[model samples]
Target: MAAFLAIIRRDLRLALRQGSDSLMVVMFFVLTVVLFPFGVGPETGVLERIAAGVLWVTALLASMLSLDRLFQADYEDGSLDLITLSPVPLSLLVMGKVAAHWLTTGLPLLLAAPVLAVLLHLNQDGFLILIVAMLLGTPTLSLIGAVGAALVLGARRGGVLLSLLVLPLYIPVLVFGVSAVDAAVMGFEVRAQLLVLSAMLLSALALCPWAAASALRQAVE
Candidate 1:
């Protein structure tokens, strides 16, 4: 327990000290979402119609931008070797790292989503549900991204490879996240979509840490 908290704190401090990684993620998210208005024109109805998909997809991509760095710093500095050999379970450490990643990456995106949604003219009725859905969904994104980050450790063009490995996996989350918001906007029952997102989060929580730990072990060996 102590080691898990320690790993999270260490990563959080490193992320804070560097700062740019998290900043880059938010900047990318804002820039990409902001571009939609220009590309699609200023049709309020059009923006409203596509807003949920645009926000969810842009958030997914923004989250991926920082994933390659999730383990790369530790792996490059040889800290990963010591971490893998620690008395504490590697899976627990991976969870700590994922938690830290979510804090730095996902949390910021969650906070930023509402503002961008307004810019996209997302229906006011869907605003609360958008936040709710992202709350259930973004951590799962971090968890799944960790496995890809771990698997691509020490590889060339790891960023590209990580995206390929994870994007397909991200589809279900994207689909349900957008669906939850859209359902709310259209006066439909959103419980089912939210339930599916919650289930995916639970499933990923159970599996991704162990999978990422195994991949990390393979990378180090």
Candidate 2:
């Protein structure tokens, strides 16, 4: 238990010390949201209609911006070797890293969504649903991303590779996440969508850590 807490604390401290890492992800979220108005023109109806999709897409892209470093820095600095040698289970270590990744990347994206909502002139009703969907959904991103991050660890142009490997997997998450908000906006029940979203997230939470750990083991080998 102490080892688990220690790993979480160490990663959180490392993430805090590297402040730009979190800020950059948040900035990307904001920038991508801002571009939507220009790309789709200044029509409120159009913006409102697609705001949920736009916000979710922006968050996905922003999260992708930081995933490579989830393992690369530690691997390059040889800390990964030390971690591999630790008595703690590798999945626990991966979970600790994923937890930090969520804090540094997912939380900021969620925090920025409301502001992004205002930019798109999103309805108040839609705003909370958007935030809710993201809160439940982005953890899945962090975990699924961990797999891609691990798989591409030593590949050439790994950033691009990570996206290619993970983006397809992200589709259902994005679809359901966006659908939840869209359903809310259209005066439909969001429960079914949220249920599916929660199910996918729970499934990913169950599986991604082990898969990522296995991929990392292979990468290190």
Candidate 3:
């Protein structure tokens, strides 16, 4: 328990010191979402119709921006070897890293989503549901991304490879996240969509840490 918290705090401290990683993620999210208005024109109805998908897709991409580095820093500095050698379970350490990643990346995206939704003319009725869906979905993004980050730890062109490996897996989260918001906007029951997102999160929570840890072990070996 102590080691888990320590790993999270250590990563959080490193993230705070670097700062640019988190800033880049938010900037990418905001800029990408902002571009939609220009590309699609200023029509409110059109923006409203596509807002959920746009925000979700952009957020998904933005989340990917920092994933390749999730373990690369530690791996490069040889800290990962020491971390893996620690008495604490590697899976728990991976969870701590994922939690830190979410705090720095996912949480910002979650907070910024509602504002961008407004810019996209997302229906006000869907605003709360958008938050709810992102809340359930973004952590899952980090969790799953951790595994990809771990898997591609030493590969060349890892960022591109990470995207290819992870994007397909991200589709379900994107689909359900957009669906929940759209359902809310259209006065449909959003419970099912939200439930599915929650289920995915739970499943990721259960499996991703262990998978990422296994990959990390192989990377170090």
Candidate 4:
């Protein structure tokens, strides 16, 4: 347990020292969402109609921005080798790093989401679902991204590779996240969409760590 916490702490400390990734991701999400108002005009109705999709897509892209570094820094500095040698289970260690990634990247995006949603004149009816959907979805993004990040550890143009590998996987989350908000906006029940999002999150939680850890082992070998 201590080692698990220690890995999370170590990754968090490193993320803090190298702060640009998180800052950049948040800024990208804000700027991308902000651009929609100008491009589509400031009509509240139009903005509200599109807000769910805009936020979900931008958040998806922004989340991808920092994933390449999740394992790259450790791998480059030989810390990854040390981690693999540790007595702690590699999957647990990978989960710790994934948690740290979500803390630095996904969590910030989740927090900034409501502010951007308001900027788009999002429907008040959807706000709760939007927040709840993102809270459930963003961590799943980090978890799946960890696999992509680990898979491309030594590959050329890894950022691009990571995106290619992961973006397709992200589609379901994007679909249901937007659906939940859109459903709420339309006065429809969002329970079904939220349930699907929860199921995906649970599935990711059960599988992604081990997949990422296996990829890490392959990368180090």
Highest lDDT among the candidates is held by which one? 1
Candidate 4 TM-score to native: 0.98
Instruction: State how far residue 111 of model 2 sits from its true place (Å).
Output: 0.5
Model 2 residue runs over 4 Å out of place are none
Q: C-alpha displacement of 48 in model 1, angstroms?
A: 0.3
Q: For model 3, name the residue pairs that clash.
A: none
Clash totals for all candidate models? 0, 0, 0, 0
Residue 23 lDDT, candidate 3, scale 0-100: 94
Model 4: number of backbone collisions: 0
Worst 10 residues of 2 by lDDT: 1-10
Per-residue CA lDDT of model 1 for 1-221, tens digit only, reads: 99999999999999999999999999999999999999999999999999999999999999999999999989999999999999999999999999999999999999999999999999999999999999999999999999999999989999999999999999999999999999999999999999999999999999999999999999999
Rank ordering of all candidates by lDDT, starting from the highest: 1, 3, 4, 2
TM-score per candidate, chains pooled: 0.99, 0.97, 0.99, 0.98
- Steric clash pairs (candidate 1): none
lDDT of 4 by residue, 79-195 (tens): 999999999999999999999999998999989999998899998899999999999999999999999999999999999999999999999999999999999999999999999
Candidate 2 lDDT at 56 equals 88
Model 1: lDDT of residue 2? 95
Residue ranges of candidate 4 with Cα displaced over 4 Å = none
